[model samples]
Target: MADIRVLIVEDDPFIAMDIESAVADELGDKAELIVVGSVAEALRATASRLSCAFLDIDVIGGKTFDLAAALLQAGTPFAFVSGSSPSDVPKALRQARFLRKPFSTREIATFLLGAISPLKPRRSRNH
Candidate 1:
């Protein structure tokens, strides 16, 4: 399989570390994890190709709605991992997968597996 680049947009250090550890546990050396704390940082990281992303709803800069929309438009697989109610998300994006805060490792692993599954076609990063 090709290398997997995963983006994690989380402001809290501990949560970022937790998500990073989970990504490491799942993909080991096969995955390159980019952990960022703000929407600005995340937007910058979008310059590179990404396999998938885990986004926190509320971050250092603001709500992740814009970031989520961009990822959606890019056809990148992603999940919203946030304490905020799912209803808080924009209506158009509510169909996307969502993982509530205090999630289990298994949940993360499952999402990662699905996101990088061979059956799922990867979108080009040209846009």
Candidate 2:
């Protein structure tokens, strides 16, 4: 859990900062937040570990569904954060979590926290 990395794909500076703070408050040292404002940056960040992700539908590349596709292929859990109820998300991501704009810090935390797996299984030592 201490090595977890959470990605946030948001274009708004203020919103990104708020989400960053919320994630820190929720996961503390258990996870680190990696924020990107565009699909290119998000794609680059994917090269590293991705425990989970929160993607804003309308980013610098127009939207984040393409980035979402990459995440799905990599088996990384993710959710959508949008100011509008976008009708353009891919069918596969329809079941993904959606947090509307103006959402509370608690809601943000809850969405990301829910995606995290429980603690890793302990290794057994044989004598």
Candidate 3:
């Protein structure tokens, strides 16, 4: 596969590390992982090219919908990785893809794989 440039936005250190580990284990050096802990930074960083993004709903002081909107406008697909329920997500993002928290590496790996893969039927990855 070509280089998979992935962005991960999460405030929790442990959770961020888990995502990083999973991506690293799955893609090794083929993955370029960008991990940020806040929504503001994630938004600014989204201006660059990204293969995909893993965003948390609740970040430090802001929600991720703004960045989600930007990614959507730019055609960069992303997945919401949060413990929050789908109802808690903004209406505009209610239909966006998601990967629930307390997730296993396999789950993360699977989501990442699908996110960067060829187009398929659009649906949330609730697992």
Candidate 4:
């Protein structure tokens, strides 16, 4: 439970890093955070072991819903960290927790930790 790995997908590098920094600050050394600027990178990262992911709904060259779908299909647990309004989120993933922009590190850490909690059950569901 201590080593919570999270991937953040955002088009803006600065914002992505900010979220990563926040996770580190809140979780200290226990947080393993990875930040990517596009859905492609996020998809690639998911091939490895991940506790959770904070995904943006819209990217410059990619769609967030597609990424969410891939995660969902793979049974990977995730949350949304977006500037978009709730109504803008895809119908399939509307149930996930959303973290608005300018969120604190503590908030990101808490979200990641909580999202990862369901992964254990996800493993069972897949099997």
Q: How close is every model to the real structure, measured as TM-score?
A: 0.90, 0.86, 0.86, 0.77
Candidate 2 residue 64 C-alpha distance from true site, Å: 0.7
The per-model lDDT (C-alpha) reads 0.90, 0.84, 0.85, 0.76
Ranked by lDDT from best down, the candidates are 1, 3, 2, 4
Query: Tens-digit lDDT track for model 2 on 10-75?
Result: 999899999889989987877878889998899899999788998999889777888888888888
Residue pairs that clash (backbone atoms under 3 angstroms), model 3: none
For model 3 the TM-score comes to: 0.86
Give the lDDT of residue 82 in candidate 4: 79
Over 4 Å off, model 3: 119-127
Q: Tens digits of per-residue lDDT for model 3 on 1-127?
A: 3367899999999999999999899778877899999987897777778888999999986999989988888888788999998788878876678888888888788878888776433477895
Best by TM-score: 1
Report the backbone clash tally of model 4. 0
Candidates 1 and 2 compared by lDDT, better number: 1
Candidate 4, residues 1-127: lDDT per residue as tens digits?
3456777888888888888787677667765777888877887888887777788888766777887877788767777777878888878888777888867777777876666665433445555
C-alpha RMSD values across all candidates: 6.3, 3.9, 6.6, 6.3
Q: Each candidate: how many clashes? A: 0, 0, 0, 0
* Top lDDT hit: 1
lDDT of 4: 0.76
